[model samples]
Structure formats: C-alpha cells, structure tokens
Target: MRLLITGGAGFIGANFVHSSVRVHPEDSLTVLDAMTYAGSRESLAAVENDIRLVQGDITDAELANKLVAESDAVVHFAAETHVDNALADPEPFLRANVIGTFTVLEAVRAHGVRLHHVSTDEVYGDLELGNARRFTESTPYNPSSPYSSTKAASDMLVRAWVRSYGVRATISNCSNNYGPYQHVEKFIPRQITNVLTGRRPKLYGSGTNVRDWIHVDDHNSAVRRILADGQIGRTYLIGAEEERDNLSVMRAILRLMDRDPDDFDHVADRAGHDLRYAIDPSALYDELGWAPKHTDFEDGLRATIDWYRDNETWWGPLKDATEAKYEGRGQ
Candidate 1:
C-alpha cells in the first residue's frame, strides 16, 4: 500500500512511520509535514531512506489533493497539539487542526481514499479524579482547551464527511503517549531531560491530575490495525490502561534517573487543566483483537530515559528552545 501520512515528522507520526517501515516492508509511505517547530527531520532520520518526505502544509488544498490522489490511504496526524500553546494563541490551532482536516477530507472524498484521523482523549473533556467512568467511543464532546476544541472540531468534520459525503474514514482518540523521539516540552520528556541536565523536575499545581499513558509504538500498532481493517465512520479509543497521576509519573522518572522522589518544584497549574483522562479501549481490543505490548509504565519510562540519554544528539538542539518557551510561560 502507498500511504500518505500528514505530520509524519512529528512525534507520534514519525513513530508510526518507523513502525510501518520496520514492520510492513511491502508498504510505501509519503510523509507530508509542515516542518513546524515540533516537527523535525531528525525524527524521521532512521527511516529517511525508506520513505518519501514532503515538506508541505496540510491546509494547502493543491498539495493535499495531489498527494491523496496518488495514495491508497491517508493517516491525518498533523495538528497544533500543545495545550499550553493553544491557551496562549489559538489561531494556529484553528488553522492547522480545523481547516487542515477539512482540506484532507475534501481531498480524500474527491479521490475515494481511505483515511484514519488521529485525535486525543481530551476531546471528551476530563473525568473526575476518582471517577470510575472511562471515556469510550460513545463519549460526548466537551473539550475545555482551545487545542482540544479544535481537535474536536476536526473529528466532527471527519464524521460529517463520512456521513454526508460517504468518505472512507476512521477516527482514533488516544490518551497521553510517551516513548522515544517525543518532544521535550511535553511532561514526561521535560522531566526526563531536566533530570539529565541536572535540574529538578517541575510539576503543575498539586500534580494530582491523572492521565492514561500509552507507549507510542503500541498506539501506532492500533492505528495500523484500524487503517487495515476498521469499519468506516467508526471511532476507536486507544489506550494501554496505564493510568498515573502527574506526581507519580514525576517520582517514577526521578527514581529511574537516581534522583530523589521529592526533588521537584511545583509551578502554577495550567488554565482549565483537565482533572483526569482514562480511555476504555475494550472495543478496539475485543473487536479487532488489538492489545498493547507496553502495559508497564515504569518499564516504558526506563526505556524512554535510556533513549534520551543515549541519543542526546537527536534531542539536544531543541532542548534549550523548548525550555525557553516554557520558562517564558512560567511553567
């Protein structure tokens, strides 16, 4: 299959590209990325010789149509994903998440190409700290942040296209992902990098907020399954059932790096921060027989720490810039 993956140079997308190239030798891939700050060529360096990289925006109608016209399937992963950045400036999120998705949907519709839309669990808002309820495919949309709201809008556009225009499309809403190649601005990497650089990890508020963590490779595996055999117009929730609070995650990272568990600072909490996000991926597991290989959070974190420690060349250039951005925000 010839696959066109948008945002293929970004964290999750690049991981997907690597997984595809390594696991599916018969498939060919063309990655369409805008080369934004979060998206880097280095992320795809390992698979650069194996896949085609197109430095273009998803909002470009002509480019999107041209790429989709020639591909067997489209995996839409491009977006303005940082919630903190969205809180400060939402215009980019709207343009990249909403309009970008519309452009992809139109191209897929015109060419009759199958599409898999990658989304986040934040679209369903947050669950209470102690609530037993987990987000399912049937959860109602209640996005709190600009980033999530735009993603929710994009998800709706895909559904609209599928129902109103009969576009072959599937959507997957996944939880927080951590693994190698993730940007340092995110929570896990930020803490890991901080410890590596001899700085204390920083937590927000009381660090009580919880998230369902999934390994990036596991997420990519589920995406592949959905792209190959999922029902059109259906939504799948992808998670590994590894739920941990922010403080716990910080302690685990510190322990892995041989730092004190309490060796961290508490910054101001994010505005409109969601309390918890847990995904119920039973439908994906039961119907598609998809199961996560990285169910142990600490084991995954140790592997991720090892990767960052061993591959400073890959993440070093962007570390100072990412930390500078966060420092300016007082986070």
Candidate 2:
C-alpha cells in the first residue's frame, strides 16, 4: 500500500509513521508537513530515510490532490491543534483545520481513495467531574474552544463527504495522547520538561480537570486497526481507560522525579476550560478486538519522562520560548 500522511512531522502523526515503517515494511510512505512551530523534522529523524518527506501545506488543494491521486490511503493529521494558541488567535485554526480538511476531503473524493480522519474527544466538550458517562461514537459535539470547534467542524466535513459523495472515510476521536515527540506546550510534556530543567511544575486552577490518557503508540495501533477492518462512514473513539485528574497527574510527575508532590505553583486556569473528558472505546475494543498496551498510567508517564530526560537536545531548543509564552500569560 502507498500511504500519504499529512502532518507526519508532528507528534502523533510522526509516531504513526515510525510504527508503520516497523510494522509494515512493504508499504511505501510519503509525509506532507508544513513544518509549523509545533512540527519538527527531528521528530522524523529515525525514519527519515525510509519515508518520502514532502514539506507542504495541507490547505493547498493542488498539492493535496496530486498526492491523494497517487496514494492508496491518506491519513489526515495536519491542523493547528494547540488550545492555548487557538484561544489567542482563531484565524489559523479556521484556515488549517477547516480549509485543510476540506482540501483533503475533495482530493480523496475525487480519487476514490480511503481516508482516516484523526480527531480529538474534546469536541464532545466536558462532562461533570464525577460523571460516569463517557464520550462514545454517537456523542453529540459540544466544542468549547476554538481548537475543538475547528476539529469538530473537520469531523463533520468528513462525515458529510462520506454520506454526500460516497467518499470512503473513517473517523477516530481520541483522548489525550502522551508520549515521545509531543510538543512541550502540552500538559504532560510541559510539566515533565519543567522538572527536568530544574523548574517547579505548574498546575492550573484547582487541578481537578480530568483527561482520559492514552499512550501515543496505543493510539496509533488503534488507527491501524480501524484502517484495516473498520466500516466506512463510522466514527471510533480511542482511549486507554486511564483517566487521571490534573492534580493527580501533576503529583505523580513530581513524585516520580523526586520532588515534593505539593511543590508546584497554582496558575490561573484558561477560560472555558473543560472540567473532564472521558472516552468509551468499546466499539474499537469489541468490534475490532483492540486494546491498549499501556493501561498503567504512571508507568507510561514514567517512560515519557525518561524520553524527555534522555532527549534534551530534542526539546531543549524550544523550552525557553514555550516557558516564556506561558510566563507572559501569568500561567
């Protein structure tokens, strides 16, 4: 199979590319990335020689169409995904998430190629902190921030194209992903990097916000499973069933790094912050016989810490800028 992966230099997409190379050596892979601030070629360093890397914008319909025409499947992952960034300026999110998705949808629809649209569970908005209900495939979207709203729009576009144009597509809305190659701005990497750099971790508000965490590898594995056996016009939710509140995760990181659990500062939380997000991935588990290998949150988090500890060169350059941005916001 020939695969064209958009945003393959970014976190989850890069991990997906690396895993695909190892698991399916026969498939030819091509990556299209814009090399945005959040994306780096260094993330794809390990598999650089194995896959063709094309630096381009996904919103370019001509580029998207040319690549889609020559591929068996396209995994659309390009987007402006940072919530903080999106909240500050929504124009980029609108252009990339909405227009980029439309470009890819048109290309795939024209070429009659299969597509897998990766999305986040934030589109379902927040459930009350103690609520037992989790987001499922049928959950109605209630996006709270510009980031999630754009993603929600992209997901809807994929669904509409599937029904309206008979486009072959599948969508998977995943929970929070934490593993290597993740940007430092994300919660897990930010705190982990802070401790590694001799800084105290920062917690937002009361730190009660909960997120269903899943290892990056586990998330990608489920994506591959969906591509192989998932039905068309279907949306699958992917999660590891490892839900942890912000305070608990912060304390765990500090404890693992030999710091006092309560040694962190409390920063003002962002506006419209969701209280909780949980995903029910029963459809992926029952229908596709898929499960996450990293069921232990602390263990996976430990491995993630080790990755940052050992790969300072990979994240060191961006640390100061990232911290400065947060510090400027008084967060």
Candidate 3:
C-alpha cells in the first residue's frame, strides 16, 4: 500500500513512520511535514532512507491534493498541538489545525481515498480529579483551551465530511503520549531533560492533575490497527489505562534518576489547565481487537529517559529556548 503520512517528522508521527518502515516494508511511505519548531528532521534520521519526506505546509490545498491524489490512504497528523503555544497565540493553531484539516478533508474527499484523523482526548476537556468516569466514544466535546478547541474543530470537520460528502474516514482520540522524539516543551520530556541537564524538575500548581499516559509506540500500533480494520465514520479512543498524577509521576522520575522526590519546584499552573483526563478505549479493543503493549508506565519512563540521555544532540539544541518560553509564562 502507498501511504501519505502528514507531520511524519513530529513526535508520535515520527515514531509511526519508523514503525511503518519496520513493520510494513512492502508499503511505500511518504511524509509531509512543515518542520516547525516542535518538529525536527533529526527525529526521522533513523528512517530517512526508508521513506520520502516532503517539507511543506498541510494548509497548502494544492500540495495536499496532489499528495492525496496519489496515495492509497492518508493519515492526517499535521497540526499546532502545544497548549502553551496556543494560549500565547491562537492564530497559528486556527490556521494549522482548522485550515490544514479542511485542506486534507477536501483532498481525500476529492480522491475517494481512505483517511484516518489523529486527535487528542483533550477535546473532551478534563474530568474532575478522582472521578471514576473516563472519556469514551460517546463523550461530548468540551474543549477548554485554544489548542484543544482547534483539534475538536478538526475532528468535527472529518465527521462532517464523512456524513456530508461520503468521505471514507475514521478518527481516533488518544490520551497523553510519552516516548522518544517528543518535544521538550511537553511535560514528561521537559522533566526528563531537566534532570539530565542538572536542573530541578518543575511541577505545575499542586501537581494533582491526572493524565492517562500511553507510550507512543503503543499509540501508533493502535492507529495502524484502526487504519487496517476500523469501521468508517467511527471514533475510537486510544489509551493504556495508565493514570498518574503530576506529583507522583515527577516523584517517580526523580526516584528513577536517583534524586530526592521532593526536590522539584512548584510553578504556577496555566489557565484552564484540565484537572484530569482519562480514556476508556473499549471500542478500540472490543471492536478492533486493539490493545496497548506498553502497560507498564515506569518501564516506559525508564526507556524514555535512556533515549533522551543518549540522544542529547537531538534535544540539547532546543532545551534552552523551550525553558525560556516556559519561564516567561512562569510555569
């Protein structure tokens, strides 16, 4: 199969691209990425020779149309995904997440190609801490931040196209992902890189915010499963059911790195920070027989730490600037 993977040089997308090359050697892969500050070519270094990487904006309708016209399937992953960045300025998020998705929707609609839209569970907003309820396929949209609102809009666009234009598309909303090639601005990688660089980890607010964490590889595997066997016009939630609070996760990182658990500093939390997010991936499992392999969160963290430790050259250049941006926000 010939596949067009948008944003394939970004964190989860890069991992997906690598896995595609390793697992589906018979398939030809092409990656379209804008190489934004959050994305880097170095992330695709290992699989650079295995796939074709196109550096272009997804909002370019002509480019999106040309690529979609030649592909068997298109996995759309390009977007401005950082909450902090979106909070600072929402214009880019509107352009990338909304307009870019519109472009992709039109292309796939025009070409009669299958499409899988990758989304985040944040679009369901946050559940109260200690709530037993988790987000499922039936959850209503209640996006909190500009970043999530844009993603919610994109997801809506896919659903609308599927109904209105008969576009062959499916959607998967995933929980928080942590693994290699992730940007330093994200929570887990920021803390891990801080420890490796001799800086204390920073926790937000009381550190009670809970997030359902899943390894990137596991997330990508579930996505592949959906693309292969999932029913059209259905939305599946992907999660490993690994729920951890910020404080506990930070303490675990500190303990694993041989530091005092309470050595971390507390920073002001961002406005509209969701108290918790949990996902129930029952539909993904029961309907598609998909299950996450990285069930052990600590083990995943250890491997992730090792990756960042060994690949300092890949993350080091962006550390200072990332921290500086956070510092400005007092978070």
Task: State the TM-score for model 3.
Answer: 0.99
Looking at candidate 2, what is the lDDT of residue 182? 97
Alpha carbon lDDT of each predicted model: 0.95, 0.95, 0.95
Question: What is the per-residue lDDT of model 3 for residues 1-331, given as tens digits with 9 covering 90 to 100?
Answer: 9999999999999999999999999999999999999789999998898999999999999999999999999998898999989999999999999999999999999999999999999999999988899998998999999999999999999999999999999999999999999999999999999999998899999999999999999999999999999999999999999999999999999999889999999999889899999999998899889888888899999999999999999999999999998988897
TM-score of each: 0.99, 0.99, 0.99
| Cα RMSD, each candidate | 0.7, 0.6, 0.6
Per-residue lDDT over 1-331 for candidate 2, one digit per residue giving the tens place of the 0 to 100 score = 9999999999999999999999999999999999999889999999999999999999999999999999999998898999999988999999999999999999999999999999999999999988899998888999999999999999999999999999999999999999999999999999999998888889999999999999999999999999989999999999999989999999999999988999999998998999999999999999999999998989999999999999999999999999999999998
For candidate 1, give the lDDT of residue 70. 94
